[model samples]
Target: MFSSDILEATVTIIPLWDSVAYITMKAVILDGEWDPRPEYECSETEADTHKSNNGSQTWKHPALHIENREKPTPESDEVLVKVRYTGVCGSDISMTHADGDRYMHYSAYVNLPNVIGHEFSGEVVETGEDVQSFSKGDLVTSEVTSYCGRCHMCRNGFNGHCENFEQLGFTIPGAFAEYVAVPEILLWDVSPLEKAYKSKDDILKAAATIEPTTITYNGLFGRAEGIRPGDYYAFHGVGPIGLTGMNVARAAGAGAVIAFEPSDERRDLARELGFEYVFNPVETDPTQAVAQVTDGMGVDVHVETAGAVAQTYPAIDETLAETANVVHISNAGEPASVDLRQYQANAAQVYGAEGHTGDRIFTGVIRLMAAGKLDNLPLVTSIFDLEEADTAIEQASKRVDGKVLIEV
Candidate 1:
């Protein structure tokens, strides 16, 4: 038995081997917490201790560095995952730049020297004594945000807004490494993918895309009073999340799925993916175009996946049908001045949706995927090795194309 104290919590581990052993694995670490203090403000002893434990040294405060860390052992109720593939998200790009004032301020739960990749899929290599839902060799992906079950929001079934929430890539160590330890409650059993998919690589790729799809699912179903079968759906932005929204909207029996994108590449990609009514918002007026397509009835549902609130909010109000629901899924940052007159005139409602309700949404997404309704392989346009994580992030940050994955 092996036991260690981390952040005042006692974690117990049972080695897979009969003998005690230590293994070092590669990881990307954000060297310091979001503190206004200078790099030199950290004591030499503290830095030295961190270097000794994590096996590398860096002086760049709030910067990402590649290092070797001892493979973490799972605590009771947790499982150790051998990461296979991880997805790079827009939030990861923002966090990489360490937007201390705006975005990072909202993510105050993030700890220092954290490992940061949240959307990942892997095989379970080990399980703690108290872990009952998973076993070694199980294929899985997990809900990165964990909530304290006793919180008022959790008790009220709003776990995504739990008063006490800690996210894996933010508040603690995440899956941008060879291995990660996560609580069992957050684990989703994707082992069924072994049979559902054509190959292991296909399953891993699908699993890596699950988190983003779930975010879109939550926005459409969980946050927006759910979508109806014959509703006309409109999406602004043709990026990964937006494309996923298109697929999900179709699966939900949307009468029509329309998209607004300025990028020719993205518009072509969407057309290739079977979207017939895509328009260039820069050239064609979004409201006029949507009205022309819908016979002036306007869209039943409008989703803003583009992070430009100033642009998307107006487009939504212009294109929304009477009694339509507009859901904003992107993190545009700060409040934008929206002309609510149109929305009020049309009796439309706007909702700000963020994060998924953990496994609940994950289960729904998985079911959709299994039934062949949520095919995301077309969106997995880029892939890189674990060593090329920075490049992967760079590609994703450009926002010029589709989903990017880092194969661990």
Candidate 2:
């Protein structure tokens, strides 16, 4: 492992003085050498070819450092954001996972030596001349995927599958900096969040969650059509997404939330979020636990956020209700055998979702936050300054807390 050279942003009261021009101060970038696995000798198989393209399965001694890179200036249709707060995602850590690491799970559309961070909330420090909808001081959080709106997939209301796309912090520079240039169309006004949170700094902290929260939002609502009122939900993981998603399901009127996590700490965090039922799948049978709690009615909405398909899918298969919806949002790399017969027997639907685009995903999440309906802010258990981000990433690897954020 790269020893958790993490990247995040901490709350910084930006001085948006009229005459002071904003310039990016510093950035956390990833630079490493590729070292492929012996098995990936470029055989004709797709998996082998895919790994071959990435130059290997993992990097070599990937290092994270605060470097003073050339500042980014917005295009005519873009705005320069001064990042205030950012959340560390697992994908960010995978960038630094080295050849000898126990596991390296991310390696698609990733061209490194790139600045890190895709989940962020910030202030608009400058706007391009053509930008009209936003001014310099607007509080904003934008989409991380840079998708061309005119593509066929984008035009058909499936922009998440946009044929032309660039993932922030993956292919390009992202938000782990003093500034990130964003196109105006991808920006969402998060100022309304000020009403729900007493502190502007906290609101910025909350807004940084918009990206990951929407991952679950897109999977459950946009892909699976969401849960009906009074429906029972079963969450396979209580990580940040599960914790925030539990709130999403509740705010949408889910009658009860049942969470199963292998981590004792995460299960406890689920309870802290006010869920009445939380279990450890490692000890108890998740399917039987759900059956016992719901009196055999089973869960109507099944969520997979643990990235452990082998463990979660079987429970999801056994505990599904009639016409149930199974939403897989975890970024699982390995394929698992599925009992397709169960889906047919129960008349259930399964939706595979990726990325947060289209379907008003961002808008709905911001609305929930603005209305004081989301309490997932408690998931943000740790916050660090830009200088201590290395320590932040180290802590994030523990996967014990709901979230860890860096204040810029």
Which prediction has the highest TM-score against the true structure?
Answer: 2
Tens digit per residue, CA lDDT, model 2, 1-408: 333333222113444442144443689987665555666554453243232234336445567889876679889999989999989888776666644553244655565577888899999988999998899889999888888989998888776677776767776789888889888888999998988999888889999998889988888888897469999999898888888888899988997889998888888888877888899888999878998888999899998888899888888989989999999888777897788899999999888988888678999999999999986688899998887777888888898988999999
**TM-score of each model, paired residue for residue:** 0.85, 0.88
Clashes of each: 0, 8
Model 1 TM-score, all chains together: 0.85
lDDT of 1 at 237: 88
Off by over 4 Å in 1: 1-22, 32-34, 37-61, 98-109
Local error of candidate 1 at residue 35 (angstroms): 3.5
Give the runs in model 2 whose Cα sits over 4 Å from its true position.
Answer: 1-24, 34-60, 99-104
lDDT of 1 by residue, 359-380 (tens): 4688888888877777888888
Query: How well does candidate 2 match the true structure in TM-score terms?
Result: 0.88
